[model samples]
Every structure is written in structure tokens, then in C-alpha cells.
Target: MTPQDAQAFLDENFAPWVRALDLTFTDLGQGTATATMPITDQTTRMGDILSGQALAAMADTIMVFACFAHYGEVKPVATTNLDTVFLRPGVGTHIRCEAEVVRAGKALLFTKATMFAEPSGKAVATATATFYLA
Candidate 1:
């Protein structure tokens, strides 16, 4: 799917809280998508650093969009499993999430995402996810 299409999908389908992150799709291809989520005070806890949970959520959300792009459009998909690791606190203007589909089968899909703080380009979090496609 095109980046425009992916943005439209995000606008239409994602929950309000997810949408509140103000994620913007910057690039999209057959099986990959790159998104940016700006860090705000409300999104942080106390240290002015981006929260790990927020980063994980953004990574998972980007992977779902990447899978949709791979499939040509939005199909019914559910997260079967998701694992995220927080490597460091994200302290930057924004975080970038690059998601790619590792494998796509008839009934399942495997994907991964890396979240990095821009400018510094430090890896803040990583996630692997399994989705059940319907």
C-alpha cells in the first residue's frame, strides 16, 4: 500500500489513544512501513523520556500496518503474540518505527519492528509479533 493509504487506514481504524500519538506514515512498500511518533509530555511518565509502553505500542501498530501493506489492503488480523524489549529510554524529539513482515502464511504472519530515537539514532525498543490472519 502507498503511504497515503496507510495513513488513511491508521486514521480510520486505530483507537483514539493510539491515534493520540499523532503517528505519521513516512514510507511504505510491499512489506514494510516507517512511521514517526512525536514524544510529548503527556506521553511520558516523569523523566521527560518516552515511555517504553508507548514505544512498544507504536511498534506493534506499525507492524500491523506493514502487514496490511503486504496484503494489499486491510484484512482481518489479530495479534496472537507480541514481545517487546526496551533497550534504553527514548529522549528525543520523536521516535521512528520501522516495521517489516518477516513471513506471511495462509493463516499467520510474523513481523518485527525497531523503534529508534531520531537525531541520536539510538535503538529504544524492538518488538516481534505474530498475527492471525482471517
Candidate 2:
């Protein structure tokens, strides 16, 4: 799917609070997806750093698109497991996550994502998720 398509999918399927994060799809390719989330009061926590919840949400959201791209269409999927590791403080104008589908099984999809603080491009967090194809 194209970036526009990804954005549309997000807007249409995600919850209102998640949509409020103001994420924008930057790129989409076969088995991959990229998105950016602006760091604002709504997305930040103590010390103005992006909250781990928001980062993890972005990782999960982008990985969903990765699965769609890998399958060449939007399919029903649910996150069965999600693990995120914060490597650095996310302090920047925004954060970007690049996600890829590592494997697509008959009933499960494995994905990984790396989040970087924009402008500096410093690694902030990484995530791995397992999605059950419904």
C-alpha cells in the first residue's frame, strides 16, 4: 500500500486516542512500513520526553501496516505479543518508526521495529511483535 493508503487505514481502523497521536505515514513498501509521530504535549510525559506508551503504540501501528504490505492487502490481525525496549530518551521534534515483517506464517506474522528521534536520528526504542492473522 501507498503512504496515503496506510494513513487512511490507520484513520479508519484505530481508536480515537491512537489517532490523536497525529502519526503520519511516510513510506510503505513490500513487507515494510515507516511512520512519524510528532512529539507534543499530548504525546510527551515527564521531562518532555515521548512516553513509552506512545512509542510502543507507534511501533505496533506501523508493524500492522508491514503485515498488510507483506500480504498485499489489509487483513484482519491482532497483536498477540508485543515487547518494546527503550534504548534512549525520546526527545526531539518527532519520532519515526521503521517496521518490517520478519516472517509471515500461515496464522502468525512476526515483525520488528526501530524508533528513532527525528532531527538527531538517535535510536530511542526497538520492538518485536507477534500478530495473529484472523
Candidate 3:
């Protein structure tokens, strides 16, 4: 999907809290989705490190679109499980996530996302998610 189309989808379908994340999709291709989130004070915790909650939410959000890319349409999907690994303290102006479908079947899909601190391109976190497609 084009960036505009991705943005429109995000605006229309996500819950208000998810929309509050302000994710901007830079690329949405078959089996993949990428987004960038600017690190604001609201998303940071003690020591000014970006909160893991925000990262997990973004990872889950991108997996929904990743399923769309895999299925060729937006299917009714729900996250059955999400696992995130905080590799390092996220310190940057922005963090970007790239998600891809690792495995896709008729009823279930597994996806993975890697988040990085921009400019320096240092790895921040990684996530894996499982979704049930109805």
C-alpha cells in the first residue's frame, strides 16, 4: 500500500489509543510493513528510555497490516500472543519498526518486528507476535 493509503487505514481502523501513537508508515509491501514513531516525553520513562509498552503496541499494530500484506486483504485478526525483547535502552529522537510475516497459514500467522533508534541505527528491541485470522 502507498503511504497515504496506509495512513488512511491507520486513522480509520485503529483504536483511539493506538491512533494516539502517531505511527507514520514509510513503506507497506507484500508481507511487510514499516513505521516510524518519534520519541516524545510522553513515551519515555525513568532515565528517558522509551517505554516498552509503546514499543510492544507499535509491534502489534504493524503485525495487523503485515497480515493484510500476507493475505492480500484485511482479514479479521486478533493478537493471540506478543513477545517483545528489549535489547537495549532506546535513546533517540525517533524509533522505527520493520515488521514482516514470518509464517502465514489459513487460520494463524506469525510475525516479527525489529525496532531501531534512527540516525545511529542502533537496535533497540525486537518483537514476535501470533495472530488468529478469522
Order candidates by lDDT, high to low. 2, 1, 3
Q: Residue by residue across 1-134, what tens digits does model 1's lDDT show?
A: 88888888889988999999999999988889899999899788788989877888898899999899888888888999999999989988999999999999999999999999987999999999999997
Instruction: Give model 2 RMSD, 1 decimal.
Output: 0.6
Better of 2 and 3 by lDDT: 2
Give the range of the ten consecutive residues with the poorest summed lDDT in model 1. Answer: 1-10
Q: Positional deviation of 59 in candidate 2, in angstroms?
A: 0.5
Choose 2 or 3, whichever is better by TM-score. 2
Q: Which ten residues in a row have the lowest lDDT in candidate 2?
A: 5-14
Q: How well does each candidate superpose onto the true structure, as a TM-score?
A: 0.96, 0.98, 0.96
Estimate, for each residue in 1-134, the C-alpha lDDT of model 2 and write its tens digit: 89999899889989998899899999999999999999999889989999999999899999999999999899999999999999999998999999999999999999999999999999999999999999
Per-residue alpha-carbon lDDT of candidate 3 for residues 28-86, written as tens digits (9 for 90 to 100): 88889999998988899999999999999999998788888777667898999999999
lDDT of each: 0.91, 0.95, 0.90
Which candidate gets the maximum TM-score versus the true structure?
2
